[model samples]
Target: MSLLSEVERDEERRAGARGDGDVDQPANAQELAAMSKLISGSGLLDVREGELEVQQRNPNSPLHSVKAFEQLNLSPKLIRGIYQMGFMRPSRIQEKALPALVADPPINMIAQSQSGTGKTAAFLLTMLSRVDPNENYCQCLCLAPTFELAKQIGEVCKRMAAYMPEVKIGYATREEKYTRDSYSNHHILIATPGTAQDWVMRYRIINMAKLRVFVLDEADVLIDQQAFRDISVRLSRHLSPGCQILLFSATFEEPVVEFARTVVPEAATIRLKRQELTLDNLLQVFARPASIDIKYQYVTLTFGLFGLAQCMVFCQSRREAEVLQKRLQSDGHDSLVLHGQMEISDRASIIRRYRNSEVRILITTNVLARGIDIAQVNVVINWELPVMRDRSPDFETYLHRIGRAGRFGKKGIGLSFVVDDTDERNLRQIEKHFCTQIHEMNMDDPVQLNELQKKVRK
Candidate 1:
């Protein structure tokens, strides 16, 4: 069916439900006020105000069984790859998302869950499963927001498909590392939206005719950015009608979710409750600095106060990241900086070094916020608050920033530097939105610092 027809049918289905007494009831003033606070504070849209929605296009799908990975009846090579990766059982999101993802007749999906929840692996498995190993062309296309993230996803795909020698994976970013000829023959391609569009329109490098699966790893971020959003929509139009589109993210604003629905109509959606959005294993804390200069001092002090294996310092702008990196380095602390303005190759190299533990502290902008997983990062320092262009508190960015740490069930720490009343208000809003408290640290008192170190060590 055409995209328009599919969307119309979905609207008709929803309309029929409304006719059958399934209409959305209006929220009273108090409820509306609470919801408004939640969205504004959390930077996350509460889908229907605290309700978690899960929809499956095919309710009676045989693949809905949440059994062992072996029970999914996947290929031996793919199964061997799974076991080789040391995955004994599926994660919650994986179990819920995989069946529909790997089911036959190819259905679209929209899945949301907390970070470090195996969402990447879930979609990677589907991409690997759906590929025709015998065929030698780009069958699966995965798009990420940043080059670092795209490279990380490509690495994961290579590892997961290690046992399957026939699955060729390619990464298309601004860097000319992967040649056009190499990309054309790749069985699976992971790329940034701009580069992907360029390859399709200008270079004519990517052939979308036989594309089977199109996965958007950070769907919310991609849809929010205007440049990426426009190119992504154009690329989707070029793909064959039967291609499966899968959208995955840690958080989805309500409007972005709606835009995704329109883009991929008849998609199955999996969303988590508001309470389930925050990572429980991550210990969140805030340090109120007397001045902006003191904020830098506190970051330096944190290094000595805790057993930090590695940490990422998040700055609001490129200038902040650069200045902080220079200051930290001058203080004899080893650090590196990453931002959008840097060369793609340099950013990729910095990410590689950070992942390898060559650099202990990596100061960066929002580039590293979403899906780059570094297991050794024990702490995340918000050098500056994440705010939107209008200077509103960015709760979604906060979640992604803290999410960089505490990956894969490991304990992590998130520390934000609040220097003024504005910062304090934003922090409080985040706490209220999540319905969780961020332990306050008194940097003036050594005893409080010691107590925080003890908690972090635990």
Candidate 2:
């Protein structure tokens, strides 16, 4: 059947399923029994096509089952630390790995799990489990690919250490001053790989004789850059005997697996895979046009009308990101631009504004796609396709872009404009990967345009 015909039939089926009885009728015993019988007789009463019915079937409802924490034969100090953070239950990943790390002889671990799955606390608890309050040398180290992520991991460490006395956690950045002695006295050192490497070479301050815990967060990004191997090599040269290493990231790509083998040779591996990580909270829609220029025009028009709390536009290059941001601002969109070429402080400030709702829209490259958490963002627009190693647009990048929205139990929308044969191929790849149907939202159709206008007006 044609797409329009299918949509129409679905709508008709829904209207018919409502039945002749008054929906607002009070539920007396007889009325309730009749309604139950009617629904049980036809699957139409249970199956729904809209967002509301799908939410009714959500497996991740707030009142959903809270997975219990495994009984790790942890010491009194570590149990006290976990309680200090007010964490009573473990996420799925945490439940599986905590006991293994706390056992008689700690085993190194490498985990491939999606973001927002509590990877931070899983590793933090393990690190805290190994820490000795009496020792002053850096005993645990967690390295992140970005300064922002390093700072976030440091904050998590602080929260976990609230009840523990005299335990210090520190992070380093070129923009910030951190004394070598300050880090020398820390029990946990959370740092960016670059900053950590700098400290290793400059101050030679890391006393690795007592260090026993090491973690690499977002391992895929570092694997892609070969920074994972470089950092692992440098760290191995300084690590104490019997040190335990952990590698964590969203995707279990092949390169990441190889890097993990070298870093944690006999480490236990865990994977959540793509199926579990795909966000069900997003409503994905595509807009197809006769040409790229028309696609650009439609994007400009739609974002102008959408008063979203926060929106991100993903482009292919620094030039494209800048030009698009300037054009949108000229059209009175008041958007900010971000990319690798900008200064560090400037990028952080733009992110702060977008996070705080000071700016409604941001245009940038893929750097912001991972490890940066902004819950208020509700819309993501793909202005340009992500290029893969084969020099073609990749579907995985598209998934990550759309995944940014509808996070943490909130509804989100993802819109993309496909304008050429190449774009069509990219769309097919996306559909095939998810086994999902991507509805094409026709901008030229008067009915759709009117509906969009009505939504924006409200």
Cα RMSD (angstroms) for every candidate in the order listed: 15.7, 17.2
Clashes of each: 0, 0
Q: Ten residues in a row with the worst lDDT in model 2?
A: 47-56
lDDT of 2 by residue, 27-120 (tens): 2222222222222221112111121111111234222222454367655666667666667677665656666666547777788654445678
lDDT of 1 by residue, 180-239 (tens): 677778889899998898888888878776789998877666766788878877888877
Whole-model Cα lDDT of every candidate shown, in order: 0.74, 0.66
Count: clashes, candidate 1: 0
Mark the regions of model 2 whose C-alpha exceeds 4 Å error after superposition.
Answer: 1-70, 75-81, 172-182, 198-202, 224-229, 276-458
Superposed Cα deviation of residue 427, candidate 2 (Å): 9.7
TM-score (C-alpha, index-matched) for candidate 1? 0.54
* Top model number, lDDT: 1
> Candidate 2, residue 63: CA error in Å?
27
